[model samples]
Target: MTAVFDTFYADDTLVDHLTKSIQYSIQSGGKRIRPLFLLETLQAFGIPISEAHFKVAAAVELIHTSSLIHDDLPAMDNDDFRRGQLTNHKVYGEAQAILAGDALLLDPYLLLSSADLNASVIVALVAELAYASGSHGMVAGQVLDMDGEQHTLTVDQLKKIHALKTGRMLTFPFVAAGIIAEQDDEIVALLRQLGEAVGQAFQIRDDILDVTATFEEIGKTPGKDVVADKSTYVKLLGLDGAKQALTEYLDIASQMLTEIEHKTQLQGEPILKQIERLRID
Candidate 1:
């Protein structure tokens, strides 16, 4: 993945700073959960790991990293650190960071289009990525989050926010795998449900960590949710309650994976195992 990112640029002289910024953001340490989900989904379908798979995974990572860059800007979370290192805006100037993020966001389409796959597959992937990352998805969640700040949000409101902001991107991997495999609509729908459960669990865990974990443990500033007065599961439910919610979501995700495995008779336990890694207790 690092090698793929490092060599992704062309005509470096004209866009050296942009190239470096993008590389720096991608190289920053992360769990690479999105790409892993995509790969694992493909593996569940018994699809062999191929260059096309790598390309798709890398594109997913690119989109995720791009969102992180923008999310750390002064207008957003306004954080100084991410992934245990200085945020991109802190290292590069804010303008450069913004441009780097923009480049990252747009470059994934190019990567997908250039992949060695059928035109229809490429089109489906591109459309899914766009909807997941665009105004209708993660971006919408961000807007709602910003708006909900300082104001208390109901459980339904909070879930709706996260379903867009975080859930949509997470759903991309499973849905994309189904598309690539040419699975029927029913199978793709099941995958989306599983991904949404995982995504919600993931975000709830993040909220828990914000209140419980230290900076070193989380790799970013902890307690920002409180400081920002943002609505969160931890803030709405008590810490114990939030933990319980996490467990429930994890169970839902696991059960969804189990059903998919039984229905398709596919090796989905690996994906279930990945979801288990998110458990806080």
Candidate 2:
């Protein structure tokens, strides 16, 4: 993926300069966690990816990337760095960055709905993605985070902040996968819980990284949360207490996955592995 991205970015020999500029920043490093979570959730449900799932999964990744691009902008987070490199706006110029981010945001739906997935599944996924990426989901969370600056919030309030900002979008893939796989209601519910827990753990880990991680390790500006003065579990609770909370969430998430009984296949699912790792710290 990284190599393809690099080559894709370097394809300036044929494309227009503006396109090249946007592609350069848009094709930067990312963990691809959203697709991975969706894939694992589908696997846990004993479903194989059809051609349609792949398209939708790719859409999931595109949306996640789009959010990161906007999040790194000077106006949004005033961030100079992202994915361990200069932000899109830093290298591409503000105008090109805006276009690139907008292109990514708008492009994925065409990609997802373009293929052979059932109309119902596509519609549901689109609605889920829209909510997650829009005012109710990731964008909502960002607004809360921005509003939270310089203000102390209760732990519940902080969770609410991240649940909308970070958790909902992260959880979207799981819900989307459940819909794609046509899982039972109980199983879908389990995936939802697992995803929320995963999002919370991921955010807490990010909070830890902000304080304990180096700028090089994170590839983006560290300690921005501190500068922003956004409330975090690490702020309300000590590092050790935050770690404890992560463990509890991970355990809760793992137990929720037991709904698909005798489904021994889920034992090695990557999402489950992620939950165990989250428990580690």
Q: Estimate the TM-score of every prediction.
A: 0.98, 0.88
Compared with the true structure, the alpha-carbon lDDT of candidate 1 equals 0.91
Which ranges of candidate 1 are over 4 A from the true structure? 10-14
How far is 280's C-alpha from truth in model 1 (Å)? 0.8
Candidate 1, clashing residue pairs?
A: none
* Pairs with backbone N, CA or C atoms under 3 Å apart (clashes), candidate 2: 84-219, 141-165
Judge candidate 2 against the unseen true structure and give its global Cα lDDT, from 0 to 1.
Answer: 0.75
Compute the lDDT of residue 205 as modeled in candidate 2. Answer: 82
Predicted candidate 1 versus true structure: per-residue lDDT over 83-149, tens digit per residue: 9999999999999999999998999998888788899999999999999999989989999999999
